[model samples]
Target: MRRIVNITILLYVLFGVSMYIYFFTGSDIGIPVEYKGTSADPTTFMNARELVLSEEYSSVKNFLFFLGTPFEWIVLFLFMVLGVSSKFEQWAKAITSKRFVQFFIYFFYFSISMFLLIFPFRFVSYQLSKAYHISVQSFSSWMKDMTIDFWVNFIMMFVAMHVLLLLMKKSKRRWWIYAWCMTVPLTLFLTFVQPVLLDPLYHEFRPLQNKQLEERILEMAEKADIPANHVYEVNMSEKTTALNAYVTGIGSNSRIVLWDTTLEKLGENEVLFIMAHEMAHYVKKHIYWGIGLGLGVSLVGFFVVYKLVSFIQRRFGKMMRVEGKGSFAVIPLLLLLFSLFSFVISPFTNYVSRYEERQADTYAIEMTKDNESAVKAFQTLAKTGLNEVDPPMLVKIFRHTHPAIVERILFLESYDGKIDR
Candidate 1:
């Protein structure tokens, strides 16, 4: 068992370090010569200092991003291997007779332990963003936000894990199928409520103060056959310099939310083009499709997890102090397995995301018929966020949800704007 743990740790470290060196070591490779003088050019959009800062930021961000999963896996594995998870479980059981109370108590300990163990990586990442002026939030504000994040995540995880364990206890052999069934509606419920209930906790949202832009956005929504009555603006400038806009929620709860930074940075038509892109997601039902794809993956994922977990329990249950298939101490092992599975499947999920984003971009161009504004919108996003307009292929595979900025801009530049009627 020690040999297995040691070997796993070594493999994780080697893979994480090697990938960081391979993809994020040097300066961004940059776009082709044809884009050099164009608005899409990174060199022209940002000064040399900003360019260097972007590279440094990307390297650190990618390092943290890539290492995060492995670190969590190791932590969870160690908790199980070192008997810490069993200790936590024992401690919780000693405190309560009620199973639900015991579960919550154990979960709180597990969640906080993991949070503290993983916090330094997050702190370093946040500090670097602040140092590079990417994040303008003060340390106090950041801490507050972190606290909010912790509680929100804790509550959500508590609910999900409680249900999962309940299902496991009821049907040890069929728990994964039962859990997957529960997960589908839970996911949809979160998506439906997030824009209204959760989002307002982090940022102040209001009707777009610029009534004219709001009117125009509503008009666009009307033209797109969307039921939106208002366009919302979030004060993201308070936290970061990043520009963003998106569609969120479903049915009556649906909203078009623009970051204040986007409104401040771009022109009316550029904003309109961005809005059109967001609206495309609604018109095309990308959110529902994304949910379907995710649930479909989760169905398969849960089954794989069930098989792997059962194999682990049969092989090493005594070593980990996991009593049986129904033991709550097994949660750490379940988490470790799920984390590994998510990392393995991320490339496929991101590929689908990129495809959807490209579709939205095309839809935006067709609806607005203003290729210049579309190009400038992407260019502005790249400059404001210090985004890599043309990242390496590996980064695109794992990290990128949208097409590279340069690709979007070049597409817009070359578009003939003949709408398909």
Candidate 2:
């Protein structure tokens, strides 16, 4: 009864605190409490020069990301405002007849235009990685991979825009509704197809070769109620020194993948803990949860676009020559709004992802019963990945999909799973 009473009091406190934080953050001039920004300051810590360097590096990277992401959207919007979309529209008229083909033409250039705008920043990030000795791939190899990525993006964008335009043409009132409905199955299908069809375009994969480790992995998978069919290794060492592992795809395409760097660098027990974490992701059915959540978010985003886009187009449409919903050029306006909405909504998305990651971390610690190994694996990961042990709170709220490495290790150290030995 005492324990129950204490728990009730604790719950009330937590609820009150959460409400306070939400209210504090929900307004136009709401506190940017997360941006206090001193957590990553090197002067704050003792003993570890590595942590200082890592945090400094992360700060630069984060700044680059902040500058680059919004810059693209701003540039695209500026082009439309400056009447570049009209010029592109004339080119599309000269080139193609089928509405689908015309959209493909517009988006091919549209996608590449964004890519070109962002490429210099990406290259700078690449140079930073090389300076840090994290990335190992040569410029030629990187360009090759990026070229493939470009084509893939172009195709995906074309199909998505074509379909969206079709939906709008048929029912402007209900297009967002139809588009929101389509997101669920499409996301699932891509998740199913990615491991089998798409992953090979970037990396080499093979069945994990160490028979002893493979046996242990299979045993762990069985214990975790996973399929235990395959453990695949990706040659990530060819690109970067980062140690990583993940369970990706679903159903037939579901597989556990380990980076070759992870295999080379981590011990067998550490590998098992990591694999257990990946298995936890599958067992939790986080993919379907993500799909459902994304569908809902997409629905909300589409509704917002539906409500506000026409007003925007009407006010600026004649100047840009992008009149009406059926105009192929409407795609750019849609993307602009979607990008802004995504930026605005990022904190909520990151919150859910971080929750799922923490759940998987707890499940991993319990399933492995090797708290030391799990902690050690995360330590190795943090070191290899150059993760900031204590990132800025704004980074956590806005961009981080997982909890900080320090918090993860601390949680493992304090966890009391107490499963029978």
Tens digits of per-residue lDDT, candidate 2, 259-318, equal 999999899999988988888899999988987888889889999998777677678677
lDDT accuracy of residue 411 in candidate 2? 80
- lDDT score for candidate 2 against the true structure: 0.78
> In candidate 2, which residue ranges exceed 4 Å CA deviation?
1-49, 319-321, 418-421
The lDDT leader among the candidates is 1
RMSD of each: 2.0, 11.3
Task: Kindly give the number of clashing pairs for every candidate.
Answer: 0, 0
lDDT of 2 at 412: 81
Residue pair clashes in candidate 1? none
Minimum summed lDDT over a 10-residue window in model 1 is located at 21-30
lDDT of candidate 1 vs native? 0.87
